[model samples]
Target: MSAMLEVVGLDTCYGRTQVLWDIGFSVAEGRTVALIGSNGAGKTTVLNTICGILRPRKGQVIFEGKPITDIPAHHLVGMGLVQVPEGRELFSRMTVMENLELAAYARRDGAVDKDIRGVLERFPVLGKRRLQISGTLSGGEQQMLAIARGLIARPRLLLLDEPSWGLAPMVIDAVFDTIKAIQAEGTTILLVEQNATQALAVADEAYVLEHGRIVLGGTAESVAMNDEVTRVYLGGFNPRGQ
Candidate 1:
């Protein structure tokens, strides 16, 4: 399969303070790739650069082989690069239905209405709270709504930043399970997650970023088993204990 998304020597900055440094990765069509690292490791920065939230200083970001590093973030959604940012940043005052509708502003899917209903059907709890204030929903529901909002965009590559943050174990499981289901349905995923254990479980391939650069890259199994990962990333948890 051809690369659905590619980043080469990507570098970003916030008013002259450079953040990312020569970062690069590739996501094949319908594949799931995780950019795993702790805080300030340029994981989220990579997602921002890919989705056009932040323009790179010098590098190439190609989506379906078209350079899009200069595209506007709002317009990038139309290009099928949808990012579900951290914190499930939903319109708390808006109803769940409204949040989902807002996500489809750029797409003209023939079954848009049907698709909304399908989302509700698949997530019955969300359906039950369809008219409720999104901000009032439980943390898990809010996270689900965020993911559902992105799916409504009919994205080709879903860029998720720290999806499992501040979530309960059960909720994190739900999120990762949903991630796998999305991949099964042919949506390429670029995930930046802190939960290495779960992220490695769902990812086809994973990259480890540290101090604004990609230091280690490999398959999920390879990452989970690495000595560096075990010593620093795993936090000394025995597999049998888990």
Candidate 2:
């Protein structure tokens, strides 16, 4: 499979303070890749840089084999690269349907309404609450809505930042289930999650980021079995059930 998204020698910063250093990885077409690390490990920064929310001081971001390192966030959205941020940044004042509609603002295709219906069917809870205010939904519902919104954009590579954050265990399971369903439908994903166990469970490839650099990269199974990853991220939980 070809690389759908590639980050080469990335260095990102907040003003004078650098947060990511020489970061590199690739998400292959139709595959899910996970980036796992502790808080402040610069995982989200990687996503932001790829989605064009932040300009990298050095390095290149290639999407579908094209250079998009300096592209603006909105333009990247139209080019089929979209990020579902960590915080579930919904339009708090808007209804579920309204928020979903706004996600397609960059899309010129006339299938917005059709896509909306499709996402609603995929997430039936959101379908029942279409008219309800997004802010009023439960934490899990909000996360679902966020993912659903990203899907509305028809992204070729989806950047998901902490999809399981702040949700109950069952809710986290549900979210992962949705992620698997989405991947099965052929949307390539680059997942950034502190929840290493779940992330490794669904990902084909895994990269471990530590203190702003990639400390390990390999198949998910190998990463899960590494001593440091098992101790620090997975809490000794064996993903392969050995």
Best by TM-score: 2
Per-candidate TM vs. native?
Answer: 0.95, 0.98
How do the residues 96-182 of candidate 1 rate in per-residue lDDT, one tens digit apiece? 999988877667767788889989997899999999999999888999999999999888889988888988999988888888889
lDDT of candidate 1 vs native?
A: 0.87
Model 1 regions more than 4 Å off: 237-242
User: Each candidate's lDDT (Cα)?
Assistant: 0.87, 0.94
Clashes of each: 0, 0
lDDT of 2 at 118: 97
